[model samples]
Target chain A: MSEHDKNTRHLARMQRKKAVVDTKIESAKISKGLLLIHTGIGKGKSTAAFGLLARALGHGMQAVVVQFIKGRSDTGEEAFFKNAANLQWHVMGDGFTWETQNAENDLASARKAWDLVQACLQDETVNLLILDEFTYALKYGWLSIDEVVAALKNRPPMQHVVITGRAAPQALIDVADTVSEVNLLKHAFQAGVQAMPGVEW
Target chain B: MSEHDKNTRHLARMQRKKAVVDTKIESAKISKGLLLIHTGIGKGKSTAAFGLLARALGHGMQAVVVQFIKGRSDTGEEAFFKNAANLQWHVMGDGFTWETQNAENDLASARKAWDLVQACLQDETVNLLILDEFTYALKYGWLSIDEVVAALKNRPPMQHVVITGRAAPQALIDVADTVSEVNLLKHAFQAGVQAMPGVEW
Candidate 1:
């Protein structure tokens, strides 16, 4: 095609796309709290939650983190945000399920974390709440799916909740405003590269 | 099952899992730069990239961000990290391709961004570099895939690079050490909810 003809075609395509996107944006007028779920077997479910936490913090909004399955407190994210006045971070896990090994103990921990989540859901002042690795609790039948969904549905008007883990329940998925599944195509760990600090954890 | 029986079974499973994970961790001893690609049609590809940027910055490492198709400088991330002493952020695109509409202009802009990427690849002091929405340039054929892959392959040994966008090329995937495809199952925008600041942006 001639250069002029190509430019005209490109312009027409863009114009059509712009009109559709603009209409979508215009129609989307409602604003309120959002339930976001990050699930699947890939990395970055929790990492992206931390990014949202950072964005919330950057805006100087009140944010809370209740890490369910990550026992380590020495992660790069914790070290960075633990000191922020607007942030409240709780690393509330014994360790990975395999490391913990006690169903009763895991249940107790899940209940304790749920207690905190309940409180946060009621507190209208909290703008963003991250339930990191929360799906395991639900997946293992440690937390009641109905109770959890009800509490999430009843959260304050503007509070944004981010739930991250693998195998999120259908109920939770149904109620969530946004859901993303991070699928692993390739991993450095499988290629004999260690999961390093800062990048992985 | 009895509580005692359940506990014993859990303990046996835990032991088996621990051994496998330990072996995996032990065998992965190679330490080097990582090429990570975050793609698929999801909400958190760039958000996760920002999270990595935060983690890198948290470690007091020198980091840089070359945003490919995002033209706006007033984004929550740019607002948060623009002034960070450890970061060098350049929003290099005119806008999204549909918005820009000029192929020649976009090609020039992409080339300019590629020039910056090449410079960063050689900078050993830079610990992390985020190429946000970089796949679009490759997808649209604005940049040479062979040349881009070659540059990425030759980057500084310890400089971590993150490339985020949709429909990432197979060539790019082949070169990446870690690849995650963020699959979008649902989004608030589709439900007529406006994209709010500090959360969506």
Candidate 2:
């Protein structure tokens, strides 16, 4: 085919694509709070959540992070957002589940974190809430999945919630407006590479 | 077994896990610049890249984003990071390839963006460089893969580069320290939901 014909064909294809996308975009008229889930055994789940936080903060949205199992260490994210305006930070993790080894203590800590999550869910002023590693709490049965899902389902109309962790509950997944599974293709850690300061923290 | 016995067994297992993780961490002693790639049809490729940028900036690192094919729309990310200190942003795409419809114009735009990329690659002051949607430039033959790989290979020792797109070249993946493929199980857009201001942009 000639170059001109190729150009014509491409334009026609794009026209069709644009029409389809426009219809889809138009069909989605109702905008309310979104429950987003990021899961799977891949990397970037929490990282992607933080990216959303940054984006939210960019829009002058008030945000809070309830770290369920990662608050023990000072991460680069915590350092960066420490004094960021219009932001609230809360760390409620004792440590990793295996490291803690005490189910009662883990349960207590998880309950404390869930209380904070409940407060965030009720607060209309807070535009975005990140429940970091929350799935572990559900998976380990530290928190009641039914109760948590109820709270999430009844959150403020315009408050967005993002839950990040592996093996998210089907109940939570069923209620989410958006869900993404970050699949692991290759990771440095698996290859005997340590998680570094900014890269892995 | 009793709860006490279960806890003890868990503690032992955790100790073993700690030893294994610690050994891997210890083996990765070298600290240097990393070439990371986020590819596949996953949702968080650029989102993950931005998360890395946020982490890099959290550490007081200078960063730059050379957006190749996302220059058409004024995205929430751009609005949020436009005035961010210690960061530089450049939008270098005329539009998506099909929208542009002219190969020569697309190639020219891609080349112009490549010039900016080359500058970012060569500048040691840039601690983190994000080549957003760069794979399209390669897939479309707007830029040479060999030249891009060569520049990436010769980057400064402490500068981290993140390439976010789909179908990343094997040559590029071969040089990357970490690669993630975001598998799309479900997308809101596919469910007739429009991209929102801060979430999709």
Q: Which of the numbered candidates is closest to the native, going by highest DockQ? A: 1
Clashing pairs in 1: none
How would you encode candidate 2's per-residue C-alpha lDDT over A62-137 as one tens digit per residue? 9999899874556778878778888888889988865676767888999988988898888999899999889999
What TM-score do all the candidates reach, one by one?
A: 0.97, 0.93
Worst 10 residues of 2 chain B by lDDT: B71-80
TM-scores of the candidates, chain A only: 0.95, 0.96
Tell me the tens digit of each residue's lDDT in model 2 across B56-96: 77777899998998755567677666777899989998887
Summarize candidate 1's per-residue lDDT along B1-201 as a digit string, tens digits. Answer: 999999899889988999999999999999988999999999889889888877777778899999998888777677766777788999999998788888889999999999999999999998999999999999899999999999999999988999999999999999999999999999999999999777887
Pairs clashing within candidate 2: B42-B182
State each model's TM-score restricted to chain B: 0.96, 0.96
True contacts kept of each: 0.67, 0.49
Candidate 1 residues lying further than 4 Å off, grouped into runs, are none
Per-model RMSD to reference: 1.3, 2.0
Best by TM-score: 1
Clash tally for model 2: 1
Writing each residue's lDDT as its tens digit, candidate 1 over A1-201 gives 999999899999998998988999999999998999999999788889988877777777899999997888778778767777788999999899888888789989999999999999999999999999999999989899999999998999899999999999899999999999999999999999998766987
